[model samples]
Target: MLKGEKLGAAIEAARIKKGISKAEMARHFGVKPPSVQGWVKYGRISKDMLPRVIRYFANEVGADHWGIEPGDPYAPDNLVQLRPKLSAAEGMVVIDRLSVQAGMGAGKLAEHFPDVIDNLRVSKDWLRRNATFTSMKNLGLVTGLGDSMEPTFSDGDALLVDRGVRDVKVDAVYVLSLNDELYIKRVQRRPDGAWLMISDNPSYEPYVIENGDRDHFQVEGRVVFAWNGRKL
Candidate 1:
């Protein structure tokens, strides 16, 4: 969880300074007033709601107001000038978009570039609660394909991959390279010691195999987050 007392109190004071009532705060986050009221009363924010609250502080009050810094934590080491106005320690995590395409079904092996295409800003507190390794070292971005992980990961969606999670920690979404092509699959360890590669969409059949048969199968990374822009 977050460093509670200080952070909670700080959030309260900042919210008051902004003159946003608990109900308004709830509406801002699209959550119920009870959630905000709970935080105001208890002076604590749960891990789940941390993203929205911290973002409010960062956007409305700025990270400095909350004793935080904004910068990309996952920007590549070789890449200089991560973001303007943000120092390395205090800025949104810079996530570079790679040319690589991870298929939700049969994937394509495309030539990838280390191009810094996008700047992604996330709360430092949120990142710490979710990501173990530094974003720069463990994070990579790719475009998703197919309908296997639909709703969870739609077609042509931008995905945030955490390379630090190279192995299956539990039954979750992970990126894998099969026979040179990359893929994003829902994976789980079967009781028989076999691995089950599943798709969120039940329409697709699961790919199950034993651990010893490591040929052609490679673990690329695990999916931490996803996004899609409906150009209307």
Candidate 2:
């Protein structure tokens, strides 16, 4: 929801809070230092780069700092609110479908924070029977692209993500951002605190994030379910 100067201010606040230098930010975005300075000074960024900028800064700080309510779009205000109320009578729960696409192969840019492109309604009983979660507050739907996860979930699958699971609590499939690209991959934490990003398809080589370079990796959410054009 932040735009123009407000957005710039939010980015500056996040940069300062995260202790990221402008030069480092420029390197990350592949721009000159002055471009990043202008982003903080004037909030000028192209439409195409807006999503990436938002995602980077939002992740550095928090989505709420940018007025982004990830899974609940109809809240009365931007301030964090309770999870969406389930219509017990109807036995239904509405989950937001986000514009972000989690690539399974070569990776893609993570797009649109808290932007609901659509909504998927499912029976509350179904969710209880199928998904495992402590709360339903951060449940969302994101499209998966590429064939790296084939046999598990094909390309163009609709993945049910739990945004609340922001860390590698267990070895599982997660939507993560690595080196500025978004991907859906199985992640395992090594004993040494490094992370192993594995593709389900053996054809693709696994990637490792060394313990010392953890700054380039971030777990955005856990993949709880995949609607692969079939049964949920």
- Full-model lDDT for every candidate: 0.65, 0.75
For candidate 1, write residues 41-160 as lDDT tens digits. Answer: 665666655544654443234444445433433223222232232323574564556656888877878443223334456666765666545355568678898998876778889887
Q: Where is model 1 poorest over a 10-residue stretch in terms of lDDT?
A: 74-83
Each candidate's TM vs. the true structure?
0.55, 0.61
Please give the TM-score that candidate 2 achieves against the real structure: 0.61
Whose lDDT is greatest here? 2
lDDT of 2 by residue, 153-187 (tens): 89889999998997888898999987768999999
Q: Residue-pair clashes per candidate, as listed?
A: 13, 0
- Cα deviation in Å at residue 153, candidate 1? 1.2
Q: What's the distance in Å from true for residue 57, model 1? A: 31
Candidate 2: which pairs clash? none
